[model samples]
Target: MELQQLRYVVAVAETNSFTRAAERCLVVQSALSHQVARLEQELGTRLFERTSRRVRLTPAGAAFLPAARQCLEAAERAAAEVAAAVGEVRGRLAVGLIPTVAAVDIPGALRAFRGRYPQVRIGLRVGPSDELTEQVREGTVDVAFLGLPATARPQGVVARELGRDPLVAVVAPGHPLAGEPVVELGRLAAEVFVDLPAGTAGRLQSDQAFAAAGLRREVAFEVTTADSLMARLVGEGLAVALLPSRYAPRLAGVTTVAVADAPERVEYAVWSRDGRTPAATAFLTAVGIDPEAGEARPAPPQEPPSV
Candidate 1:
């Protein structure tokens, strides 16, 4: 039988009058009566004894009232739960982050977001910018912290630029260059260095900076992950590394110096979807970067007229 039929049966039993039950259900008297009658027939039981003076539940009707009430209650609760899961503020959310975030600003952002939306269960994944971008594109993750130069923007993906985290040189303590308060690119270019793996954002940034200076880094080694890069810089004592300043600042055995000429890494965020949905909106607000606010490029300079 339909849910309304069960609800009508319960209401009629409780009110002990078809007229009152119909009014309570905001339906015409005949409609409520018909629904109850349909339910009783479907159940193969006579649920009420009717008389000209009054109406009363039969033994079968009395037995079914509690169960019918329970069924209606269960249905309403199921509807509420589904609504909550779909658009309400309570449920699981998946987020992806670049490695730099675990070291820099994300922990605080996550702590604050958790406090704001306690009912939301957050799942976080961390990796390089390339992988995180792909995850957001593939819908493998709901939202992610990413660096710019994303290889592909999946259709309908939205991005927000949080801020820039510039590249810095990380040299082991006691290294000759560590004592220099402000180490310039010219100095760094001559030093032996452990470079990021070729083709990665970090490596590209390093190459571009050195190329601009008309110098090349003495690349002694290379690594793919930031953690590996940090560990190697500490363990090997062989060469310095170029890393996001936020990550470098957290390492104890390393001295972080802003690369005077290294191109900054622009941090951003990408989400697979968006709208007025509660969790999606909150997720987008937190780490999501604004794309419209990219590095402000200067207008072309006008050359002075020749005499």
Candidate 2:
């Protein structure tokens, strides 16, 4: 019946341990258990089957979990709204970033935001663009930076593009394609590639491009979203990699060439369509994004200078 009881139930469901949930809620184990027990009694159905080894949610508990989470979220949003009305920006802010986004100066933005709102706690999570977009949809991430296809947009999220990052082919200095200004993707069908893993925006784009050209891509090595590793692999002549032009200047021992007919990848500032916290809004502004205007500010063009 009470909000605290709802919170306790949700916490227990998430952690699956009364003691751990109590620790998370900053309360004693007995008190937390008593509150959940009271709620179960009033509802006249056992929510959880607790054993010494583990705690599992019952059928009734499974059905109630989603509504319980919604209630807690609503309460938190209400509190945030009231605090914002008084011009206070003190709360936790969750931010998501892709592993290879280089256009925005994230550290600089965080520095300025800290100077302005010292009380706001910041949590940063890095993942592939697809994973980050899912976190945004789940309400776990307040805002995110995502690299997406030119024609595809995530549903139910408000996205503001910061800029487009053109894809380029990177290879060692002595590689056969190193001297070329632009190389067709189909030409590399026989060459081994150092590619991003599946479920990433870059990988998705690469797959679609090769398929369209009727070329079966061969990846010699699969890597996470770390650009440095990809650069190192390509610089060593292990395999060629498709990367953003922003990396050309920094990656030594590598030549970056344009991929002929390759599609440009767009980076977006994505957030939930619902109300956002004032702190999140301020951070967005600090990062050079107008949250309300939703304007498209293109990044400066990157030409792979001879490096």
Once fitted onto the true fold, the runs of candidate 1 whose alpha carbons sit more than 4 angstroms away are 1-87, 102-104, 115-119, 149-156, 228-232, 273-277, 286-307
Model 1: per-residue Cα lDDT over 1-307, one tens digit each = 8889887887777888999989899999999888788887888989999888788899998898877876774565455457667765655567887666522266776787888788877888877767777766665566777664322322356765555656777887777766666678888887788866777765776777778788877887776657755555654578888777655665566776656666677666666643223454565555433334422222234332111
Per-residue lDDT for 194 in model 2?
Answer: 89
Could you estimate the TM-score for every candidate? Answer: 0.59, 0.86
Error of 2 at 236 (Å): 4.5
Q: Which is the leading candidate under lDDT?
A: 2
Q: Please give, for residues 1-307, the per-residue lDDT of candidate 2 as tens digits.
A: 9999999998999899999999999999999999999999999999999998999899999999999988887787678778889988867789999877877878888999999999888999998888888888888899998887776776778888777667788889889988888888888777899888875777887788788788897888999865678788998889997776674556777887777777677888999887687878988888888888886455566665553
Clash number for candidate 1: 5
Itemize residue pairs with steric clashes in candidate 1. 160-289, 160-290, 161-289, 161-290, 162-289
Best prediction by TM-score: 2
Q: What lDDT, from 0 to 1, does candidate 2 have? A: 0.83
Clashes of each: 5, 0
